[model samples]
Target: MSQPPLVEMIGIEKHFGGVRAVDHVSLDLFPGEVVGVLGHNGAGKSCLMRILAGAMIPNAGEIRVNGSPVSFADPNDAREAGIETIYQTLALADHLDAPSNLFLGRELKTRLGNLDDARMLAESRKVLARLNPNFKNLQDPVSSLSGGQRQVIAIARAIYFDTRVLIMDEPTAALGPSETAMVANLIRQLQSEGIGILLVSHDMHDVFDLCDRVVVMNKGRLVGAHRIDEVTKDDVLSLIVKGELPADWTARNLEAAQ
Candidate 1:
């Protein structure tokens, strides 16, 4: 805990016309930790993350990475800062193979400036192996892969570029139990590698199981933040629904339940 946070969003605010999408929100993500951003559909969690990802510019407030202030004009800026976002869409070209997708825009080239298929394949294999050893369909189109495999491809692409802060939105959405488990294991591995993760999820189980801490947002404002062991699922649910912590909420309440 002595180490400084890897990413900090202080007094972040975003407005859509007269509507406030994010209101004076502040968040911190430490190295090797997973912080869940929980909220209903319109609670501004996604907007806040998008700003950090450089997908959207915040109307006000400042973002700090490794204690230095930064401004992102676009997603590429964020990528250069070692921040990557994996949305639910996965964003893969259906016809492209794993290696092609891994280096879609930033393809490696030979000295003569020709596409380097062999080198790209080798690099893809290395990163994918670190994520999923069982994966062997390197030549297969990503559309043919399972949901979990596709998720791996998306995640692999992010980390292959030396991502330091990862924002995953509904990472395990629509996956079966085994696939979800695979993603969970991947998350733990990334954490072990000292990557800071900001997880946005609607599934209580996924948040509780994977996150070290949880922060809730409601009506464009922060409602509550708690450690995983200090709050129950119902406590988070109350914050999401009522826009505030429960009246009698306390860390001891969770200990008593156990």
Candidate 2:
């Protein structure tokens, strides 16, 4: 039998005063798989992601990790459950170096009751090497690093804590070709280790290239879910613009319903 998904958000709902930002939506992320979430701005993608990241609570829904029901009070609660989110901003302190930023809030302390710089540096190197072998300058502040390097730092911090589910928002946004390739390699590496990833991105190329499955949303509701190989860009675009599934998709549903 197949194992349960690493994470499942079922029938999620969210509202802002009189506005319904997210309707009843369900999504799942499986181990060693990448699921891409696509939608235009104000399409409720961010709101849904925030709920999954524990930055916002759903007005109604259920969240499960490893088949067990969970309720996240905050981002820390999500982190404790092995869920990590790397927002678009990267969320790294510019003045801090890789080791410092990696262990910013969750610092390692020595027996003498002081910060363990040595241990932190060693741990930082190990994680960075796993993601970016060319990564050096562990002591240099993040402000001095390039965009890709800074992204590496953010991703490293997320996975350093035994992360099982990673939510990345616009991970390769504004990155150059080479930098984008580097991040892509790191994503593949993570998948090989059985870590499930939920990627929310506007870039269609990235979605087609990296994701195993694509889930499209429109007007706060899920339009459809499609396997990467089974659907075309036009099919996804039709869903985004018209909120209608492709003819083939509709036929498949009809066959399944009979």
Best by TM-score: 1
Model 2 bad stretches (over 4 Å): 246-258
RMSD of each: 2.2, 3.0
What lDDT does model 1 reach?
0.92
How well does each candidate superpose onto the true structure, as a TM-score?
Answer: 0.91, 0.90
Error of 1 at 228 (Å): 2.0
* lDDT digits (tens) for residues 1-258 of candidate 1: 888899999999999999999999999999999999999999999899899989899999999999999999998899999999888788899999999998987899999999999999999999999878998999999999988788888989988898899999898886788878878998899999999999999999889889999999999999888888888898899999998778877795556887
Q: Which candidate leads in lDDT?
A: 1
lDDT of candidate 2? 0.89
Give the clashing residue pairs of candidate 2, or none.
none
